[model samples]
Target chain A: MRTKNQKIRDFVLSAISVIVLIALWCAVSTSKPDFFPTPMATIERLVKLFEKPIMKVSIWGHIFASLKRVLFAIGASIIIGVGLGLIMGWNKKVRAAIYPIIMTLRPIPPIAWIPLIILLFGVGEFPKVLLVFIGSVFPILLNTISAVSMVDDMYLKVGKVYKANTWQTLHHIVFPASMPTILAGIKIAISSGWMVVVAAEMLASKSGLGFLITRGRDSYDVALIMVAMILIGIVGAALSIVFSFIERRLCGWMSS
Target chain B: MASKDIKVQVNHLTKKFGDLLVLDDISFNINKGEFVCIVGPTGCGKTTFLNLLTRLIEPTSGEILIDGKPADPHVHNISFVFQEPSAFPWLTAQQNIEYGLKIKKKSSEEIKSQVDKIIGLLGLEKFRNAYPHEMSVSMEQRVVIGRAFALNPDLLLMDEPYGQMDIKMRYYLEDEVIRLWKATGSTVLFITHNLEEAVYLAERVLILSNKPAKIKAEKKVDLPRPRSVSDDKFVEIRKDITDMIKWW
Candidate 1:
């Protein structure tokens, strides 16, 4: 079919573009060998990193540590954020009371809260998770609020005409209508969560991808830092791919 | 017509937005299992009338009575199919059809049987498992209509359900709607700007004036079932309604 052929062509085009980017990186690195690590050298270092341990954990161990923190934070944020967002969207009184406070807190960068968070929770997993939670929760909450408010009034009328109760209307109509936008917010939240977790780990942590990079910087191991950086990019991309797959499955109707 | 019981009675239904009245002292009675089409000029508050009937909006002064009591969606089984396709995109065709039954807390077996029957009736069996995005526009509207009819509502309200479709699809869906209406024996009040569609579908066509929409005229179409638009009688009825709807 034409679509299949077009998909294959698209794949090939994207592969070629990536290859060109790598070739450009190779050329630039060759010209400044002392400062920049070549793509080959970085790949070699990445493979070598698996054999050894950084801060008493291997590369996979560090990835797991970061993953554990980010996933926990994102999970908690989703539960709290979605619940609060839906309630706020449905109830004008609640929205009037809480939205102003949320708006005030949302603009401050998660990193700016490091000192206060550290002072309260210490340099433990709790503080790092909280930092990521702060970074991710607002976008998810705000997006959910907007999505809930923007659900077509026509759909609500359908619910009403069916004699659907308030609970049924929210469950059946409002929730699904808001899903695509909420999924988009989750995508954004994941990336922001990743960034915040790295910054938190780099500031005060012993075993994470972020700490691996910071440790490399402290010890002047540029190749090790590059390895950690590349791994972080790959992991972030993989997470995004997972979210996109879920979004496609859940929100297939929007695309059509 | 004299023997048929009145299913819906609108008594002095008036709606005003601030100083501007949209509907003025509208009173009508729809007979049990009757198919009635309302036609009016563009922006003549035709939808406002339907909305007030469904209580999507409250009337300034009026009452919509069903079965000798004030109409309440909670107390009555009412379904509405909007002009635009209102199928829930997240649900498959089968699930969309089952939505009302599920909301009413019907048993799983009941839901399945009802959904299966409606899907078959709508000719959506081929696309029952397909999501809204996977189907064509007309097919999506079929799903929407199927969802409404599956509830076997006491009253079914449609607001120009085929206004967006081409002539071919419109004719096909119009027939499908007629089939569904006859099979279910539900009282239907369909609103449209298309006079031919009104004449084709309704047993009686209600014509409304410009702003502050009131019933200007009501024409009875005594044509037999499966009526033809090309028939001389159909054209004459369509022409009569068209002339009544003209503002200038």
Candidate 2:
């Protein structure tokens, strides 16, 4: 009962906060017309963006391009990272051999690998996707390794007493026990992958939301830049909402 | 006892954790289809004793035999209920009960029938689909107990499975365990610190000394089924065991 009331209060508070933010933006824009674009001007620019191509494509086309790169990168990262992580976590020999390399690579920012990735794959779709993959894979892999390695010994003992083979134990016990942590890792990976894709596009892409921002800056169209920024924010927020919903569904056991 | 009737035999079982000795030269025998409870003082290495018997921890020196052969989990069907709640959080009550049978590669139809029987016997029909986190502590323990009994294991080892529950719930689950044991006819080795629980549940109660635990006394209770705590024999047996292990 209390939670229902709290939920309503939380929703009302969030809505009021957004309204206040937009009102502040509008007030600031009125005072400095040339420097800051008003909320109306940004919304108008966003609508006009759909009518005409900003960089050889419509707004949705740019969004789809960015979305495609991020989704592919994240998908590949989850598959490869989770597989390698489980192996590394389960086997001492593999963990000793591979964990050092991962630790050394993980600290370096993904943007720092942009030049090398471009040289290796060329300035096409591969480089952008690779950068996003590099950005996302480490977090997912590290979290999976920890999750699998730190599984409660009690659960393993349960498996042992049940006469479960190693494969059965892994599939039935370890995998399910680590799922909540793995889902958390996936959430982190998606946002990180999204950010890397934008940075990669800003540096080299001919079409994408990042490219739209760059084009707007080159033309000194502040409203257009604001529009792109707003779209990026909205898309990022939407992705997060989708991931949270998935987490709640899949890991409901963790919470309740 | 006849060799064929001895389901479990622990010969000079000892366990040492590095420099620290936990179980000291413990030897016991459990007959086929017997309900035995091991009672000791708090932290008297009861869990270590169960773990050694279940082969979760290797014995420093000794042998655990089941049916005249070395006890191997791979060859024998052994189920354990830990002191803590051991239900899988991801699975519902019914699914947890099916876990052991599934591991044994039983047919799907057989698994369903066994699960249905255990769930019904445990009176978990209403909370059949509830996950571990969604259920109360007693219910979670019931799921764990149901999971262990579903396999009809050769030996069922329980380590204070109801230590965290209230007296009412503990007595209720203890009765349920007795019902399951009678119905399934599996050999049971239950370890707990509660003397009343031992007298109430076991045909034979093994008492242990504190620390480096060794069997101090063994009392046989020939009382009839559904013995009450207030009964003369039950109270006498509970008092005798309680006095045997009295530290304070």
What TM-scores do the predictions have?
0.91, 0.94
Off by over 4 Å in 1: A1-44, B1-4, B232-248
- Second chain TM-score per prediction? 0.96, 0.96
The best candidate in terms of TM-score: 2
Query: Lowest lDDT 10-mer window, candidate 1 chain B?
Result: B239-248
Error of 2 at B85 (Å): 0.7
Put down candidate 1 lDDT per residue, A66-113, tens digits, no spaces. Answer: 999999999999998888999998888999999999999999999999
- In candidate 2, stretches whose alpha carbon ends up further than 4 angstroms from where it belongs are A1-9, A31-35, B17-21, B246-248
CAPRI quality level assigned to candidate 1 from its DockQ score: medium
* Model 1 chain A, TM-score vs. native: 0.94
Give TM-score values for chain A, per-prediction.
0.94, 0.95
Which pairs clash (backbone N, Cα, C closer than 3 Å) in model 2? Answer: none
Assess the local accuracy of residue A199 in candidate 2 as a C-alpha lDDT between 0 and 100.
Answer: 90
